[model samples]
Target: MTWTSYGATCSAPSAGYSASTFASAVQLLAAAQCFSEESLPDSSDQNFAAYDFIIVGAGASGCVLANRLSEIEHWNVLLIEAGGDPPVESSIPGYHFSLHNSDFNWRYKTVNDGRTNQGNQDGCIYWPRGKMVGGSTNINAMMYVQGNSEDYQRWFDAGNTEWTVEDVRRCFRKSENYQDQLLDQDPDIRNHYGHDGPLVINTFNSTERVRGNKLISAYDEIGIKKVKDINVANAFGAAIMTVTASNGERNSMSKAYLVPIKDRKNFSIMKNALVTKVLINDLNQAYGVLVEQNGVTVTIHANIEVILSAGALNTPQILMLSGIGPKEHLESKGIQTIVDLPMVGQNLIDHLLFPITVFSDELTENSEADDEFDNLKYFHNRSGPLAQNVVLDTFAFYATNEDAKYPEFEAYVLRKRKNSSGLKKEFVTLFRFTDHVADSIVELNQNHTLHLFLLSLLHPLSSGTITLSSNNPKDPPLINANYFADDNDLELMVSGIQKLLELLDTEYFKSIGGFLGRTRTPNCDELELGSREYWKCQCLDIVSTVFHPVKTCKMGQLESDSVVSSRLKVHGVENLRVVDGSVMPNHISGNTMAPCVMVAERAAELIKEDYNLY
Candidate 1:
């Protein structure tokens, strides 16, 4: 048996003569200046190689880490991504419809779509990961909400001391820049929010379709209470949504973390340079990576460290490819096993969300009218849905009993009004009144599609893994999400689903006509509350993913059934660490984006402290 070698950089990356694969590489890496390929400059120069640190998959944590580490005067950083940059449509506030099926979408389908696939209402579920530069954040809904204190405390209890609420809180504070006055009266909220940071945070301004005030008022009427700003340390009630945007344009982690420093002399980024595997020496220490570029293979050694920030899905994939995962799985792919770590890709978790579709003819009629339009008007004037968060228009975090264990309730309002009916259903006109008045210029032609995105950990007790499909670099790893395997998880979600019906029954649905239209994916006309059987049938039929995938590479101090220590260093491997959602010991209480960003901030500090960066 012989180990073939070919690389435009140093040793093994074949300069294939295959015209077809070369064209594919050429098509992928045409613009090689801003972000060059991890391979080489061209056919002539195939030996120019190496970097101080090679970070793969420019996602949330990867981008931030690249930016922070490369900032050092003498450090050399090489950031490689398998994808391209986002398109113009992804930047449009109203272009969310285009994001799902476009080029930016990785569009990885599930292997077990039949068992737990609410996202793919139609036969198969499509796990749309961003294959572009900024990764998923470029295409995500962009609602920025941090996990609560208890969420991180759970990590602390799980033996991750560095992940305690206070430890993680510092990271959360790094990305915040609050501009809310109500926070002045509330010390708890004020203490949590930071006044200085790279990202911007502000309340949703007033608009015709949706206003922050109107939402706060409505949620308040139901005893949910009004929050000055939910991003603060304590998130109790409804507050304006935080976003990853600046001046209406989405602020992707790539732009916020990397593009600004593109001109830095020591910094180099290779777009379309998919890392095939991390190169480990005889001592089992990671030293570099093998990347396939425009029809060429290349080796780029990391003189200092090899950091894996490929995100939840791809991070574990790369580790497995490098033979640093479960020994048996790699052997099946005909690859030599390095360190056998059982937890490399286990503990996968994600939110399976269900939208309670409803129609609103009277706008604020559910004790509310056809109020969904208020958001468009809000966005139009930079105040309504456009200014405020589409997810936080209204929400709740509640426990069913006096001594409940975890929060089992979370509901967000969405005013689809007239927008959701175009493909098949007939749209109705928007007629309303009150705090939000439709702008005369923005004459109301229709109603809104109001639905609540809810998910209470359907597979909380269940664990999953990420294994290699083949040794091929282009292939995505097998994602066994282990969704809905626990009965306790079902109990919590069912309770929330039942409560949602009650909210609808309270004149909320009747005021707007009482019948929330059905999804085209699968329609359920016979929804009755008297029986759990009927409810489960609809839930299994209609619910989909909220797109928050976490815990692929769990971290803990105990080191049992864990991939990395609480510090995020890979077990038994020196100069190698996994940073990103993959390191999350447990899922956060809310959106995973904010928490992922917080992870980058804290991890950067830890890296600096360990290296004594001043």
Candidate 2:
């Protein structure tokens, strides 16, 4: 075919395009086909045939299970996702923020509790969950953090004997394929991670390396010393984050684990299928699922097991719908109760985020044409501003005291270019900030470069709940994220904000004329800026989730206190299991994607042992 026809075949514009534009379009089309479309397996037609395993929600954990369980040639593995395949934007690291509120996102908003997050729109924070095959992995910033080893120790100490620190470490390594060049220079760091695994982990090919290094030095000036690798150092200090991307593209769990085994004869995937309820019999055993797809409802049976990886919110919703939740709540909704697990939707926990904005004159905003050229650069060479998650790839973990081993707070720096026009929309849409709040941020960015220190309270004393809004499976669950319900959480957050404010006085920040930007809020108008009370007020008004929700289906020994056992099997229910972020009994010190992979890795081994597959 001629060059023009070849470009047309790849969906490039045939006319009214510059030569560079045509070439870039063709390159992007080829990359999408090679990296995503061609590697993804075709969705299976809805079938009533019984399978050995039925996995719900093709999310991070679910994708891992699909690959591991399907490794057995005799087992028929069916993985179902509510959304279709990830769009081309998901494969591009720079487009991560664009996935929010899109078709691939569940776009769930927390039920407004008048007590918290009042500054947000409708007094509620938006909770974005992935609906597609890779789930949140496709949409997340792609940081690969394993959290502190002590986080797993807390789980083991909480009667979860199967999740010891050593076991958790091994499982984390098992799923990791450490591809960062730092491994070649440092033996200790090399030994810290797995070299041969499905998930590719490397440092982002960031264009802002110079600024990142300067930021690291600034963090060091404020007592959070720079570390060689955050994972090797157990997240004790600041570092350029290791991420789950390689060669300028996002390596989502679907691409890392599922794509390699797409041709397996025993594996099957059902896309755009929403699982309404688990099919349970009178004997308290799950047999199948009730799925809604393409305006049709059907029952798909599982001969051996039914696994729920539908995430923190949906897993609990599905259990309650299946009559396996609290007796009072189920009966109130006119659903018969089979097993009264009172903690089914209780003890909801998440890392709460509060943004602290600062401004400087050193950074320059990219123009619209510059952004377009960035896209062209990425398409041509896979190296540009689009090659990384921008400033989100640099982070720091710190504790209140210098002697502490684990961090109480985590911070991610996001740079908003000076005079940028999208800052208001990002604040309003991505963060669901109110118009007043969004406008205040945009007004500041109009004059100077905005440096947002997105601070996360790693662990909180306050917890919330996820409950049924109605008996209807189609109805979204009520997410009562009671952030800062406890007074201690607010106090700690104030301290964390003070810690990050120290950056303003650092040499690196001072050299760039950095200064804290006062966020205009009605409640804090009278309070002195930078005061303890001012920070406290901001904590309550600006608090939202870092998108890590867990513990709705907590894992523990008692049926009264938790929903699943250490093996991840649902308590009081046979042939059913929950393997997702919801199974976390407590909050970890960092982002949750990597830990969820570890949970699935260990859960897979336990399943193999139970079934004698090894």
Which candidate's TM-score is highest?
Answer: 2
Clashes of each: 40, 0
How far is 588's C-alpha from truth in model 2 (Å)?
1.1
What Cα-based lDDT does every candidate model obtain?
A: 0.63, 0.86
The list of candidate 1 runs beyond 4 A from truth reads 1-48, 118-122, 179-191, 204-218, 221-223, 363-392, 402-406, 418-459, 505-510, 515-530
Tens-digit lDDT string for candidate 2 (254-342):
98889888899889899888899999887888999998988898889999999999999999999999998999999999999999999
Q: What is the lDDT of residue 469 in candidate 2?
A: 94
Off by over 4 Å in 2: 1-39, 363-368
RMSD in order of candidates: 10.4, 3.5
lDDT at 77, model 2: 93
lDDT of 1 by residue, 121-189 (tens): 233355678776778877776777786677777888887776767767777777676655654457776
TM-score of each model, in listed order: 0.80, 0.94
